[model samples]
Structure formats: structure tokens, C-alpha cells
Target: MELEALHQVQGVQGSSYPIYLGEGLLDDALPNMIVERGYTNIAIATNETLEPLYGKPLVKRLREYDSYMIVLPDDEKYSGLNTVHIIFNQLLLRNADRSTVIVALGGRVIIELVSFVGATYMYGVDVINCPTTPLAMVDTSIGGKGAIDLPQGRNLIGTFKDPIAVFADLQSLETLPVSEMRNGLAGIVKTALVGDPDLIDMLTPDDQSRLAYRPERLRTIIERAMAVKVPIVEADHTGLGERLHLNLGYTFAFALEKATGYKLPHGEALAVGLVAAVRLSHRMGLCDAALVQRTEQVLQSLNPSNAPVSYAIPQGRAIDVWEAMRHDPKWRQGKARFVLLQGPGQPIIHDDVPQELVLEVIESLADGVYPRPRSWRMVL
Candidate 1:
């Protein structure tokens, strides 16, 4: 049964790879990927957490080729320089060379690890991103921003190497924790807020004034978000130009993640970041207060606290996440750059964002200065 729901994203950016989005695509996508890429030898880079679930199936499918599976420890905390070294060691031991295709078969952590290795390995090798999580599919796995976390900051060591292909199997999302699913939505929200007015409309309901998460609805949202991202990446494959627009939502997202010591998932921090951007936009007179409030309403509806797991992150953690942002290399010159919304589909990268304003917006959310929708209002 071929799932016709898949959306094919033609590479407007770096290498002109294809993004396959749909259910039950793995069966067809994996083998075709190997043959199409001319990868006679392949390595599946995964983590202990995901190896048990999909690794064997993938291995069996690609068994005809000289394939090896590399599994790393499966926790976000373990994603670091040491992890990168382990991947390199395995690749070297396997005699993986330029012809070897590194298949990142897990979430953001695994993708970052493999992509980093691919970028630096023998001056670069082929990388195929097989993102299993919604977070990976909608955000991390799409763009070529690869990095591992450091004690001082998250993604401190990384590179901009676009993947040869990104195969996002939505069926894999079934295995993801609810927290991770919600976290992935944060990226979609950021994509919308930065640009993609159509996505913003889809995310915000007219009658309810809140965000809604229907599977079909989300698929379209993810597609729209990718549309916004692909063009920017195409214009500046190395992130030297319009690509900075994508980072507008990311700056706050990364800072919040670091501030919380990564206790918060990437998507949760992104939700906070989107709200921060909206508030910042309002303060800068780029957008209206109503727009900010409406945006908050949509986000509050999708907050992870409303999920079955109800991840209770502390206010102190959120503050710490903000503090960590201060040390980010991008902010090294004592000034932070932010992507603030000028209007729907209009995102302006501002290098002059006041530190005070950024701090105030984070504090407001942490302190409940702004009213959170009842659905998301909870004492952490």
C-alpha cells in the first residue's frame, strides 16, 4: 500500500535532495535511497533507544549492500563531542570512505552526530537523514544545522552541511513520547511566526482563538513550514544570507533549551521562543498586541503540560535557559540577533534586539505577567 499523502520537497537549497513525507514510506524509500544515491556501502547510524524498533527492518531491507549499523547511547544528555568521536571510531573501524553513505536513523541527536562526521570525514561524505521523530521530521532533520551539545552551551560545536536526502516517515512518530511530539510542533510554530502566514492561520483557530493539533492539520502545517524554510536555505545554502531568518525562532528556542539545562524538549523551548518573538515584535512596534495575544493563545493550547505526561519544568530552569543564551557564540559581540515578525510572511532579522527586552519577555512568561490560556496554565 503506497501512501500517496507524501509531500516531495525538491532541493531548492544545497544538493537538491528530496524530502519524502508520509506514512509507510520506509519500505519503499530506504532501498530506493541506497540504489539512487549509488551507495554500494552504507552505515546506519542510530541510538540504543531506536535500534530495537526500526533498525532490524532497515538492516534486512538493505542487507544486499555492505551495510553496518552504528548505535550510540540514546539520551539527549549523551549527545556531545565524545559521541561524535565514537561515531568516527566506528566509521574508521568499518573502513567507511567517501563512497560510504551515513544514514542518520534516529532523532535530532543522531542526525547531528552523523552529519557532523559526514561533513568532516575525508572532506565530506554522503548523509541520508531518516528522522523517526516528529521533531526531527518537521524541524531538526530538514535543515542542515548539525551540532552536539557542550557543557557550556547546546550546539556549540557544529557545521552547516545539508543532507543528501531527508526521509521523514510520519509512522515513526507513533513511537515518540508526547513531550517530543509537542516539542516538534514548536518548530512548526516558529516557522509560521517567522513567515508563512497561511500556516499561522491554520495554527490559530478563529472561533477558539487557540492552537489545534489534528494529525492531517499538522501535516499541512509542517509542509507550509518547510516551504518557508526551503527557499531561505536555497538562497543561502551556507547560511550567509536570507537563511538567518530561520534562526529568528531558533535563537530564543536554543537559549530556552540551554537555560533549562535541556530539561525542556527543543519544541517546548521553541514554543516559549515563539511567544518571546511575538512579544518582542509587539514591543518593537512591528506587530500589534492583539497579534501577540492571539499567537500566545495558539501556543498555550499546544503546551506539553496539557499532555498525558505533563512535563513540569521549573520557572528557575526557564530563567537559566535564558541565561545560557547569553553565552552563545552568535551573541559573542555582546549583541543578540533575533528574527522578529514585521507582518505575516515578513520576518526581519534584527541585530539590535535589546537584551533588556529579551529578558523581560522571558521573565513575563515565567512570572505569568501575560495570561496563559487556561488549558496551558499550570504551576510547575
Candidate 2:
């Protein structure tokens, strides 16, 4: 299969690198890319679940070269200082120097921890990302924002280190569970909602289910979604300005994940949070009711159950979620800021969102009072 490459300008000064996506990308393209970049030693950091599936095959390909592997737990509970330390220890044991290249292979958890490790080890080192899941392929792996969760909330500890190159091996996605597939779709949906409205047409309830089984369509969807993210990262690599527009639905999304002990996947939580954001946007008169309806309609299409309601907050937990949101990484001066949409593809960062209205929207979602798409009850 032919590999497609796109260059993304990263960091404050706009350093550039290519993002390669397609099946069989690791066969020769990845190794050649690594050597051309002048990396000497190679280290593969991945989760145990993915080690055998992907990490091993990659290690085999680079067997003639000096390489090491560090496998971490796939669970969020294991994503923290300890994991980073373990990876660093491995690098130290292997005598990995500044020229050592860290290859982050796996889903979001592995990507976050490995990226952070690569950034912190020897202050910084080059990293090549082979994002195995759709979520990483489209969003996280491309943006250069590496983070680890703490007791306070998700992504509490993080750093920015652009990958030397991002190799998205689409074949790796063949084994992804349906839940993970849906999780990745959440990123694509958010991309369309906030930036590329035309991409929304691909996510209709009627056609979305087919995407999980169709590789060609999935590739097109990912490429279109990344088109929305690449320019934003190029313009605001540090995420101090325009890039915050991509925070749409993240406040509520993280709070929900915390409340559920991460029982809900990140993308699913974001889908529910998207509905809440749309509801609040309507309440604030930032968008018409039709927009909220349409947004929820697309989200509900992701899963079999009626969203936001299917993943309802437990009784008396609405206030808990609100409290958690106050501690969001983006909150400023005790105010919970949100990326509110003015309309499809028009997003504005607003910290003035009224707390009472926010609480009202959460309470309504808890009570299942917010209007949802009519076809939500039918399972695809």
C-alpha cells in the first residue's frame, strides 16, 4: 500500500516534520525515516496489551539495530510518574543517549506516557510516533501535546515535544475493539463540529456504522479530520491562543471520566460532553436549537444507546461533576471556561459561562430531559 505523508509545522518557531498514514507503513518507510533523521539507538515504549500485537513486530524489523522495549500497563491507573520513571530507567539501562529515538506504539495511554518520557529523558530526545489507534492517528499523536493524568484530573501533568515523524500504521487498527473505534470517532466528530463542517456528512447515523468495517472510508475520514488539526497546531503549537478552540466539550468530558473512575472511555465521555456543550451553547443563545439537535443526532449515532442519557451521571453527582470541572486544567480564577460554538464550524473560547446555566444543563442531562434524536433507540 502507498503511504501518504503530510508536513506539520510544530513548536513556537514552526519546526516541521511529516505524518505518514496507511497500511504497511512500518515495513520500510518507518525504518528509512528513522535513519534519515540521524537517530542512533531506538527504544519502543508501549502497553503490554499492544507489545505482542505491534511492538514485537516493530522490534523484529529493527533487530539489526540497537533497540530496547519497555512495556507499560494499558490501564489509566498505571499512567503516571511511575510509568515515566520505568521508561527512563529502561533507557538508562540501555545506555540510550541523546541520539536515542523513542518509538511510541499503541493507543492514547501508551502515546501519552511515552511522549512524556521522551520529552523528559535527557531533557529531550527525538520521538517517532506510530499511533495504532484511530484516536491517536487523527488527533493526539499529531498535536505534540503529551500528558499524564494525576489524582486531580486528566492530563494534569504534561509537556509539548513534537515527534520527529508520526507513522500512523492503519493496519494496526484492524484489531481495535468496537468501543475503541467509537472512541476514535468522537475525535473525528469533534474535529468536524469545531472546524470542518463538511466532514460531518460522513458521520450521519445511517453511515457511521459502516465506517468501522470500511478501511478506505476510515482513511478518508482520518485525513479530513487531521486537515482540521494540522493547521491549528502549526499556528498555535504552544496551545496558548487559537488552539484552545479545540477544547470543545473537554471540560465536561474530563469531569465525567473522573466521576466514573474512567469506566467511560475518553471519546464516549467527550461525546456526552459535546451534547452538554451544545445545550449550554443554546441556553447562552450562542447557537440555535436546531444546531444542538443536529449535533446530538450525530453523537447518538456513535453507539447503540441514547448518549448523555446512556452514560448518565449518578444521582446527586451533578454537583460533584461541576466541582470537578472547576479544577479543569484550563479553568482560570475559579471560573470554568468552555469552548462554546457560535454555529457549525464557528467556535469561541468563553470563560464567562454562567455557573447556574452550566449546572442546569448537567441536571437536565442527569434527568434525561434534554431532547435527543428520535432514532436513538434503534441499535445499528
Candidate 3:
């Protein structure tokens, strides 16, 4: 057995499972746990890029059983109902049964896809997670909010399917590209500002550099981020109330992603979104300008995988961005809701914020730079 420590997540109807965090869990601990529990059937669903990296090795370890690997397309654009059908076909063809465990073996898209399948296939089979990216480890994989994007809107189709267990192997993050690391770090920053305020300081350059190879610092960040989400998720299994706090910057972030035609990495869009959220918060007099100043400063300091992180939503597209927001699930009857920050660890959901005011704040961020708090970070 490896040194991975396990934390349990409570699900709806008293269902719960352990999330294991450490190195060597995939190749060593997973097979051992399966054998100890007398599991004879297993399936791993991952993307094409990750199959060679983590999937194949685990399949080899579990080769003696009815273990199979289903590799889908690699990017976010490929995730949809079509991808879900692809997994279903493979599971059906292989005769995976009620007790079969489906392992979601990649990042956000793969986690959502495989977990959804595991929930619906054969009226539910056991599923577990092996989240590879920092975004997945800290945010996506921890919560059982499963969904795939629809042409109508992002995360339009989905379920709340908790996995039987989760293994977030720090070793897997070694090869995470500079581009993806930005998304992961951005997720962490958002999580910090909303729930775990102490974590904001640890997201510095040195820690990010250490995160490149050192598992200890990586584990700390992952745990702290999860600490913020787990209890809220337990309290609000359905995201109708407190859980909404966790999405502090996402209302504007989703708009930015759509305005750019989904080309912006989620982390980049989130960084810009945090800036926008605080700006809106200031506009509403919810917080002082100092909070906004500090939000951008922390985000700018993050340089993951050794690349400077600076990207913005398209300028002169506030209308396009507004339409995107209207399409979000949070928008109701032409009145939008925003998760505003009164301060770090002090997030409030502000509803019916005037559409014109929302547009004003968003337009101000076009081309990426907001009015300077004199040392504000994001460049327009």
C-alpha cells in the first residue's frame, strides 16, 4: 500500500466514499484495493492523450481481471452526449455488469463523462475517480456535480453521481502542460478567495514551481481546496444555496468563455472572471476597492508551468458576453445573479443586479484591463 491518506465525502442518502490523495495509488493501491474487495470487473474511461500516460499502466496492473480501457477524444470540445454514447457502446460490448467499477481517469471532461455513465449505465454501477489535473484534484473531481456541455449551454445535461472512491495521484501532475496548469491554479485561486482564505498565500510562484515535482506542497493545496467544498457539498447536495458560494467568479467566467467561443482556457477565463466579479462587487458597494486590488494581484502572481498567465475576454464584446450570461442557468427572467465578494471568505449571492450595471462592469473588462486600483494585476 502507498502512503495516500483518505478523506470521506458524504453524499445524498447517506452514501459516502473515500478520496485518496498521494503518489503510487494508481499502479499499486488501486489493484490491491480491488483485489481486497474481491472486484472482478473494472473499466477505465479516459481521453486519448491520457491513455498512454496513466490508463495503460493501470490496465496492465489489473490485467488478470476483466479490466478494459476506453479512450475518448482529448480536448474539451469533444465532450458531449456523443462521447457518453461512445462509452456506453464499449461498456455494452464488453458486457460490463451491475458491479463493474468505472474509473474516470483524467481531468474535468473525462471525470464528468465517465461518472455520468457509471451512474446511468445499468441503472448505476460503482464508479471511482483518478483525477490527474490540479483543477480536477481540487475542484471538479471532489464534487459529484456531473454534466457535459450542450450546444444550448455549458453543463446543460448532467447528474449528481458520487464515485465509490477517488485517487488523485500527485505523480500524474508531473506532465501537466503549462496551459492546463493555468486552469488548475485559477480554480485553486477561486476556491481560496471563496472558502479557504489561508490558501491564497500558498499559490505563489515558488509553491507552483515546487508543485512541478514536489508532492507535499501539491497535497496541501489540494486538501485545503477540498476542505472548502466538501462540507458545503454535503450540506447542499443540490447547488440551490450555500454551494453557490463556491462559484464566486464563475458567473462572469462563463460569459467570458462563451464570448471568446470557448477558446480561452478555463483558468485564464477564471482569472479574468475573478477580476470582473470583484469589480461588480465594488460597483454595488459590496466591498472596498482594496479587495478588488488584492484579487488581481494574487492572480497575476501565479505563473504555473513557468509561463506568465495573462489573457482576457475579447474587447467590444460585452453584448455577446451578456447574452452568454443570460443563457447560464443562474439567469432568471432577465434578472441575473452574481456571487459577489464582500471580502475573502465573505461571499454573498447578489440577485437582480441591474442588467445595465452588469453590462457596464463586463464592458469595462473588455480588452482585459480594468480601471487601476493603482497596482491592480490584469492588463486590459
User: For residues 1-380, could you state the per-residue lDDT of candidate 1 as single tens digits?
Assistant: 43343434344342466787876667777777687767877889998878878887888888888888998887888788888888888989999999899989988788888888888988888898988876677667766778878888778888877787788776776676655666566666677766666575665445442343455665676677777777666667656567767766677777766666676666566676777787888888898788787677767655534321122336545456456777665564777767788876678877767767776676666543222233431111
Please give the ranking of all candidate structures by TM-score, highest first, separated by commas: 2, 3, 1
lDDT of 2 by residue, 1-380 (tens): 54557655455554687888778887788877766666669998888888888778778888778876888877767887777788888899999988889999888888888788878889898888888888788888877888988877888888988888899888887887655676687778788988998888886656544533667877888888888889998888778888888888888889888877777766668778888888999999899998898887787656555444335667777888888787786778877789989999999888867888988888767645323333322122
Q: Report the CA-based lDDT of candidate 2 relative to the real structure.
A: 0.79
TM-score of each: 0.84, 0.92, 0.91
Model 3 misplaced stretches (Cα beyond 4 Å): 1-4, 206-213, 304-316, 367-380
The deviation in Å at residue 320 for candidate 1 is: 5.3
lDDT of 3 by residue, 215-291 (tens): 67678888888888888888898788998888888888877777778877676778888888988999999999988
Candidates' RMSD to native: 4.8, 3.5, 4.5
Candidate number with greatest TM-score: 2
